[model samples]
Target: MKDYDDTTWFLGQWGRFQQTVFFLLCASVFPNGFGAFSLVYLTDIPSHSCLVPDVNLTQDWHKAIIPIKVVNGKQEWSSCSRYRLDVVRNLSALAYVPGRDVNLTDLELEACVDGWTYSRDVYQSTVVSEFDLVCSDQWKQPFTSTVYFLGVLVGSFFSGQLSDEFGRKPIFFGTMAVQTVFTFVAIFSPSWTVFCILLFISGLGQISNYISAFVLGTEILTGNVRVLFSSLGVCLAFAFGYMMLPLFAYFLRDWRSLLLALSLPGLLYLPLWWFIPESPRWLLSQGRVREAEAILREAARKNKLQAPQIIFDNYHVDADETEKQPKEHLSIFHLLKTRNIRNTTVILCMVWFTLSTGYFGLSLNTSRLHANPYISCFISAAVEVPAYISSWLALRYLPRRISVICILLLGGVSLYFIQLVPQSLSELSVALEMLGKYGLTTGTALMFVYTAELYPTVLRNTATGTCTTVSRVGSCIAPFLLQLSTYLKYLPYITLGTLAVASAFATLFLPESFGRPLPQTIQQMYRRESSLKCPFITRKKPSKAVVLSESKL
Candidate 1:
């Protein structure tokens, strides 16, 4: 609510620099967090097919009907299991394994496959028509990637609190340094278990870096710009995240090398810290009005403008211990207890869970030594851009509920078609993913921006963080659900699609939140909804000439 229009420094070049650095800094998340998430598409899983052979299984020994176990994407157990069965067939076709070990292979090795396969999603996939790698059953995939997401969930939940308490710049730099250090440890871990453990821990650090970028970005802009571009920042980062995905997969060549390549972005961002300024908004919020004033003066000095006469303490920040002793007590825990808040959380979480599972589910499965993993990744990422553009349009022009409903519906129906599509037009398989991507991406972005807008600023950070946490709970399950259905890929998509639609419909009960100032309480939100639909109520303005005549009700 504080206006910096009087602050002469924010009016020119410094403002532009601040906005530019904010975006570039957030771009680091792509190479750090998302690169790990997309590792499934890039990692090579040992695969074999009962139906086809792309490599010479006989070079090692004569094989026919080789059950090749191909590790497509990150090496998880579900992928391993499918790869193991397929590998054995191809191994047997070239030269069979001892007959007795087949049972042992299935039993003793199931754990290994599970280790490689258990993603956060529930459904799973294996080599069927497209993917055809035939080689060593051993594939290197880091389980630490899941741990990284767990870390992200935690870091994102608390970044606002920590950055506000500490300083935005410190948390940002510290977390990036941590990411660099742990990434090196993971790259050189002697054992896979040790590596995964470190990877999980690294995620906690990497996630906070993303949060710092968001907070800093918001603080740098005016209200009108903040509403549009802050949301645009996420879209840009994600779009670039998806675009970088295929590029990384194409270059890194191996999981370790790929990870090492991903870590280099930290170094790219580290140099930026020197030029980046502390958030003036956060400085005021933390009661460091003097420092806020100094920073504003610095920005003005950099822009060659004089500081305005405005005092540093002029802006009122509603947060912190003194002014907020009791008023800050919207009670973060209370959000869970209220029926409306609870409903909003559940609906949002369901959408996030389904979108990730459906989108990542299909795309990840189709990567790694397919007819073309690069082509597949490119197509899927390409489809999602439209989703982002569509969302930006929806936010710009349409009502919240209707716009959300349309995308969710498109995504849901498209999912069902995946079950019936002809593989000959095989590209359509990935094309359908757009439906889910468009819906889920739009919903998630909208939910984050809208959730903050719905709650009072006192608990705005808490509400958005809590909502993201619920979505993370869903993310924790996406890997498992995604891999569970290797034998039946369509089932998971269908179920996820349905859940997305249902969540969209559920959202209808919540009122629209466009152009209105955020409500100070859940009670305020409800009262406003009621006022809009007040029955038998009409107001007529008396003509200008009759303004002097007062009416008594």
Candidate 2:
């Protein structure tokens, strides 16, 4: 029987139909860029001091009311503590000035019980300032990001099965709607709890929309076009959206306004439903050959070509034979049922987890960089454009394993070396951090293409979803990893760097899939063989059955 690629060759790669699907799908992912990392500005903790009410006091006493603590070799007003207001008032009445007649250090300190006066020099307002998520409550800020990733975790868990069960178009648009509606509604949340709950729900749709677009593109587009779409098309769209985030945040400093700006772009994607078609490969897998053929005919028409009347003659037979088996048996457990697949899944999971951790850790930590938060974030998002371009080139030419290893090591080394840069050369530190981000972004873009190529058509969505779901675990931990910096300034970098390098080594175990046809069955999955010269360089040949099946094409 002819495979999906050969069977649908009439559609022509890079034709009008492919171009329409490619651009529209990429456009669909634009909102996700900002939606994923908006929390950076939304939850930012600006410079704040305890809010002291007006009392009969000298200017020195008013300034001295807030305790001073040395941080990083410089004395600054304490954000969380202040001298006792009653003591300051009494001292002022005695005609005694702070540090003149009385030592300011002698005054007792108290928590910011009254409230905090947040500086508006950077952000007009953030979730941290609005909800007073400062001092002891500061933990909630990072936890808020974690909560959204937790939603991504849950959404990724089911997105695969849902996409596979239904068609790709439905799930893609459906999740986009879910994300948009929830994010829009979240702006009106009365409390942090309500906001978090809405964020979690929106997260479910965010990743699902992204994954669905990926799978749909990979399934519909063929050969180099598929590789390009996977590597640059979808990823750069996301990068563009991500880049737009800082621009929006730069203008809209208020958390609610920024969120509302992010939420509104999703509405622009609603028109895409009519333009993007469902994945025909998925249609054929479900024994819906007629529907699949109809889509192909329309594609052929759009491309100004004639498709044969009997497009899926052999495919129909193959689909019917496969349909005899019970559908319920094809669960995620099937991935682990075979040794070759099990090994691939395990290694890929580890790689995904580590990459996700490093990617999001650096992304979310942009606000903390020793630069303007807006510029830092903009630079962070901007770097991804070239990173993905590099990824596209690598995916198109290099072997998958070597690409993964080199990029991972680049990220790891750059991040690990950050601590060695002298404090005086703070610019070098930021440069190393951006370099690390560049490497990870390239690695992340390549992984999507690599993973899609490794799995069979039947299990592709499930496998991709599983890997992303595992990666979300790393994302969920990412915000807290930044929190580690409070104790040891370079802790997050050291940990993320170590994990990236370790995962690079893990990639050595997986078989290469570049220049090989995507497998259609578990039996066709790449298995380790003693005949290969170099594990990383050599691409494994398909089994005899798959070879014979493709020869017929």
Q: Pick the candidate with the highest TM-score.
A: 2
Model 2 bad stretches (over 4 Å): 316-329, 526-553
Instruction: Please state the error at residue 532 of candidate 2 in Å.
Output: 6.8
List, residue by residue over 18-109, the lDDT tens digit for candidate 2: 99999999898899998998998999889999999977888888877888889989999899999999988988898898888998777788
> What would the per-residue lDDT of candidate 1 be over residues 256-363, giving only the tens digit for each residue?
666677677677777777777887655554456688777777666665667776655455533421343223334456555544455555665565555555554554
Q: Which RMSD values do the candidates have, in order?
A: 9.4, 3.5
Model 2 score (lDDT): 0.86
TM-scores of all candidate predictions against the true structure: 0.72, 0.94
Each candidate's number of clashing pairs is 61, 0
Cand. 2 TM to true fold: 0.94
Candidate 1 residue 111 Cα shift, in angstroms, is 13
